[model samples]
Target: MSLESHRAACAALTLLVACGPAMADLQVAVGATSESTVALKVEVDRIVPLASLHPRLELRLATGLLLLSSEEEDGNAAWLLSPALRWTFSGERGAFLEAGIGGALFLETRVDSRELSTAFQFEDRLALGLPWASGELSLALTHYSNAGIKRPNDGLETLTLGYRYPL
Candidate 1:
C-alpha cells in the first residue's frame, strides 16, 4: 500500500480500538517541560476478554501530539498513534505500577527542515496510578525513539499527570 493509504488505515484502526465500549475509561492529559515544549494525549483501552489476562494485561490506544518545540531541529509538531499493551503489577487495578511498550507511526519525523531518520518509532512508558472514588490519577514517564533503525535517532521524553474517567 502507498504511504498515505497506510497512514489512513492506521488511523482508522486506532479510532476503532479507541472507541470501544461505552463503559470504557477515557484519559486526557497535557504535559509541559522546562524547555517550553508541550505534549497532549488522549487514551482509552480496548477490552480483550481473556480469562488469563483480562484485568492484568490490557490493550490501550494512545494518541498524542508533541508541539511547540524550542529547538529548531526538533520541528514543530509530531503526531503519534500507538496501540499499547500495559501490564499492571496489581492485576485488578486500584493502586498499581504499569509498564507499556508499543510502536508508533508519526505523521512527520522531520523538524526544522531536518529529517529524524524515520517516521516509525517505539514508545515506552512507566506509570504509577491510584484509583480515586470517581477516577484514576497517574504519573507517567514516556519515551519515544527510532531504536537506531535510522541515523540521527533523537529520542524524546515526557513526564505527565493523567486522569482517567469512566464514560
Candidate 2:
C-alpha cells in the first residue's frame, strides 16, 4: 500500500469508531478467499431498529477492517464502513438476514496478480445470523470491487464464519 493510501484508510477507520453510536456489537471472522488467500475481519455493528419501516426490519451501521493474506506476499487489506438493513424472521429466535453496500479502501491496489486499479473500492455483503444466549453466530459472504468505474476491476470475494458479541 502507498503511504498516503494507508494513512487515509486509517483515518477513516478511526473516524468511524470515534463517532459511532452507543450500542454496538463487535464481530470477528476468519475465512479464505475463492483463490485460497487467508482472510480475517473485525467489525462493529451499530444497531438501529426501524419499526416504522417494518416491525421485523432494522438498520445497522457497519464499520470494519479486513485483512487478506497474499499468495506471493503482495500487500492485501481493506477497510470498510457501510450501512445495512437487516430483516429478522424469527422474532424470539433472533435469526436474521442482512445485505449491505458500502465503500472500501484497499491497502494495495494489486494483490498478487489481481490489479484492483484503485485504492477506493466498493463493499457488498450478505449475511445470515442466529443468536444464542451468549452471542450470535453468522455466516457471511463479502465482495469488494471497483464497479467497472476503472479498468482491471478484478474483484475479491470471501466467505466467512463470524462470532458477534455485544459490547
Candidate 3:
C-alpha cells in the first residue's frame, strides 16, 4: 500500500471512532456478486438526527469481512472497514451512496505460482432499499478497486442484490 492510501485509511478510521457513540443500529446482511462470490457483512449504523438541517441526514460506520468463493476455483478473503454518509429522502425508501476503504488479502495457495499480494481496496456503492417488517431487501451497484498498487489493476465491478435483517 502507498503512503497516501495508508494515511487515508487511518484518517477514516479515526473519524469513525470519534463518531461511534452516536450510532445505534445493527444490521446483518448477505449478498451475491456477479463474479459468483457471496458476501456476508454486519454493520452498526447510527442515524445522526439533523432536524435542524433541510432534508435530514444520517452517517454510518461499518466494519466487516468478505469471504469470496468460486465453485470451480479456490476461495479468497478480504477484511473491510468503512465509514460513510447517507442522506434520506423519505425514511424507509431512500437512495444512499457509500464508500469503503479497506485491505484485500488474496490467498497465496490458490494462485498459479503461490504468489501473495495485499492491496488497498476502495469501493463505492449506490443502494436502494425496500423495508420489510423484520428486514429489508437492497439493490446495489458496487465498484471495487485496488487503487493502482498492483499491476494490471483492472478492478472488479459487481452488481449486488442483498437482504438485511436488523440485529
Candidate 4:
C-alpha cells in the first residue's frame, strides 16, 4: 500500500472513532476472512433509536485489516472502513441476533493476484451475540462484494468472533 493510502486510512479511522457517543461500546473482533485470510477488526457502536426497524438498533462505525497469508500472498493486506446500521432481536440480554449492512472502501483492490475490480464494495453481516452487564461476546458472518458494479466482482467472506466492552 502507498503511504498516501495509509494516511487516508488513519485519518478516516480517527474520524470514525472520534465522532462516536461518549458512552459507546468498543469492540475488538478477530477471525478468518477466508480459508487463506485472517482479519482483525475494531468498531465503535452506539445505540440509536429506530423503533420501526427494531427496538435495539445501533449506528456502527468500524475499521479492520485483512491479512493474507499464502506463499506470494504473504504480506498482502487491506484496510477497510465501514459505516453500518445494526438491528438486534430477542432483546439485549441472553441470546440475540443482529443483522447489518453497509458500504465499505478497501485500500487495495487486488490481493494474491485476484482482482476485486474496484475498491468500493458492499458488506452484509449477521451476528449472534450474548450480552453481559460489562460487555458482550459475538460471532459474526460477513460478506463483502462489489455487487456487479464491475466485472469479476469476486467476493470475500469472513467469520469473526468479537468482544465488546463499554467505553
Candidate 5:
C-alpha cells in the first residue's frame, strides 16, 4: 500500500525464497573492512537449492552495520542489506564466486550536526571452505553510489575479509 509496506513485503518474500525446500547450508560471518574509514560487520548467508530451470548454485542474504570514527568529529554509521547469487565449485575443498546488489543507509553525526542518506551498492565476493571443519574464508569488494536520488552522491569503495562458521 505504501513505500515502507512495499519494502517490507519485498524483504519478506526474499527471505522466504532464500529458505525454500532446496536450502542446504547456513553460515554466519564476522569481519572488518578498509574503506573511507574502518568498519566491522557481521553477516549471514544461506545456500539456496537450484532447480533445472533456474540452474543457480546458491542464493545468499546478508545484513551489516558499519561505523566510521573520526578524531575531529563524532562518527558515522551505515546499515547494509544485500541479496546475492553464487556458483559453487566442489573440490577436495569448496570454493564459490558471488555477486549481488543492495542498498545502504548512512547516518552521520557530529558534535551538533546529523545527516541521513542512502545509496545503492554493487558487490563481488569469493570464498573457500572446509566442509570437515565447517569453516570458511571470504573476500569481498563493494562499491556504493546514490542511484540518482539527488542526495549526497559521494561514493565509497571497500575491501573486506571474513571468517564464517556454519550453523
Candidate 6:
C-alpha cells in the first residue's frame, strides 16, 4: 500500500478508537513474540452475541480496532481493524476458553525477516482466561497471516499475558 493509504487507514482507525468508548471495553496488553520482540496492543471489544448454545456456552461477535507496536528493527507498527467472533465457554467460577477468528489490515508488509507480501491478513486467537480483581486475565496466543493470498506469506505469532477491565 502507498504511504498515503496507510495514513488514511490510520486516521480512520483513530476515529473508531475515539468513538469506541461509548459501546465497548478498552483493552491494553503488553507482550512479546517467540523471537522476543516486545509489543504493545490497544483494543476495544463489545459483546454482541450470536447464540447461547448452553447455559455455559455463549457465542459473541466482537468488533474492535487494534493498534499494535512492536520492537522490530524497522520500528514498523500495525493497525488492525476487524470484527472477531468469540466463543466463550464457561468453566468453573469465571474461567472460560476464548477463541476468535478475524481478518486485519496489516499496515506494514515487511517486519524484520518476515515478508508478508500483502497488507491484508487473517487473525486467529486462543486464550485461557479467568476473572480477577474486577478484570479478566488471560494468556493468549495470536497469529497473523495472509492465508496464501499472495506469495512469500510469512506469518507472525505472538503470545501475550493480558488483562481486560470493563469500563
- Per-model TM-score on C-alpha atoms: 0.67, 0.85, 0.63, 0.75, 0.62, 0.77
lDDT of 6 by residue, 123-160 (tens): 88887888888778878788889999999998788788
- Candidate 4 residue runs with Cα over 4 Å from true position: 1-23, 51-71, 74-91
Candidate 5 Cα outliers beyond 4 Å, as residue runs: 1-36, 51-56, 91-93, 109-132
- Cα displacement (angstroms), candidate 6, residue 135, comes to 1.4
For model 6, the run of ten residues with the poorest summed lDDT: 60-69
**What C-alpha RMSD separates each model from the true structure?**
5.8, 2.9, 7.9, 3.4, 7.8, 3.6
Candidate 4 lDDT, 10-111, residue by residue in tens = 675576567555637677788876655667676766656566775777655655544444455433355555555665666655566666677666667865
lDDT of each: 0.62, 0.80, 0.52, 0.68, 0.52, 0.67
| Best first by TM-score, ranked | 2, 6, 4, 1, 3, 5
**Model 3 stretches with alpha carbons more than 4 Å out:** 1-23, 50-53, 91-117
Q: Model 6's lDDT to the true fold? A: 0.67
User: Which residue pairs does candidate 4 place in steric collision?
Assistant: none
Model 5 pairs in collision: none
Off by over 4 Å in 6: 1-17, 49-51, 63-72, 81-93
Model 2 segments more than 4 A misplaced:
1-23
- lDDT at position 96, candidate 1: 62
lDDT of 3 by residue, 1-167 (tens): 33553455446445544554554445555665555566544444554555566454655556544445455445444446555565665754454544444444332213222222334566666666666666666666655666666655555644656665543
TM-score winner between 1 and 2, please give it: 2
Report residue 45 deviation for candidate 2 (angstroms): 2.0
TM-score comparison, 1 vs 5, better candidate: 1
Query: Which 10 residues in a row give candidate 3 its minimum summed lDDT?
Result: 107-116
Clashing pairs in 1: 75-111
Better of 2 and 4 by lDDT: 2
Task: TM-score for candidate 3, please give it.
Answer: 0.63
